[model samples]
Target: MTPQMRHRLVHAGWLAAALAALGGVFVLYVHPDFLVTLVDQVWSCF
Candidate 1:
């Protein structure tokens, strides 16, 4: 890949990871029950 393409991809990956981390923080601090619901949904698929 070109240098510019590689740079863009790396930046995008970092942004996605940062957004995911922020979401986790919000869920932990603002809505702790989100985790419980998430687990329940996941288990329900079984």
Candidate 2:
């Protein structure tokens, strides 16, 4: 692939990752119980 195409693909990948991160944050904010459960599970693993 061309350099320009590769650059565009890299940029798109970063954007997609950022949006997914933001979505996950929103979900956690809306349902804090999920976060609590996750923490509990992790603590149990120790």
Candidate 3:
């Protein structure tokens, strides 16, 4: 592939990865149990 095409592909891949991560976080946040557990775990660290 051309250099420009490779650069675009890399940028697109990063965007896709970020979107997937956000989606995963959104799914987790949609569950009340997950948020409670997460808060408990964080609170335990202090």
Candidate 4:
């Protein structure tokens, strides 16, 4: 592959990863149990 094509592929990979992370966060936010479990875990660290 060309250097320019490789650069574009890398950029697309990062964008995809970011989108997936955001989607996962959104799904977790929509689930109350996940929030409660997350809070409990954090609180335990204190």
- List the candidate 1 regions with Cα displacement exceeding 4 Å: 33-46
What is the overall TM-score of model 2 with all chains considered together? 0.87
Arranged by TM-score with the best first, the candidates are 2, 4, 3, 1
lDDT string for model 2 (11-46, tens) is 999999999999999999999999999999999999
lDDT of 1 by residue, 1-46 (tens): 9999999999999999999999889878798688789899999999
The digit string of per-residue lDDT tens for model 4 on 1-46 reads 9999999999999999999999999998899798899899999999
Q: What is the lDDT, from 0 to 100, of the residue 46 in candidate 1?
A: 100
lDDT of every predicted structure (CA atoms): 0.93, 0.99, 0.95, 0.96
TM-score per model over all chains: 0.63, 0.87, 0.68, 0.73
lDDT tens digits, residues 1-46, model 3?
9999999999999999999999999998789798899899999999
Q: After superposition, how far is residue 23 of candidate 4 from its true place, in Å?
A: 0.2
| Model 3: pairs clashing at backbone N, Cα or C within 3 Å | none
Cα RMSD to the true fold for all candidates: 3.5, 1.0, 1.8, 1.5
lDDT of 2 at 17: 100
Count of steric clashes across candidates, in order: 0, 0, 0, 0
What's the true lDDT of residue 3 in model 3? 100
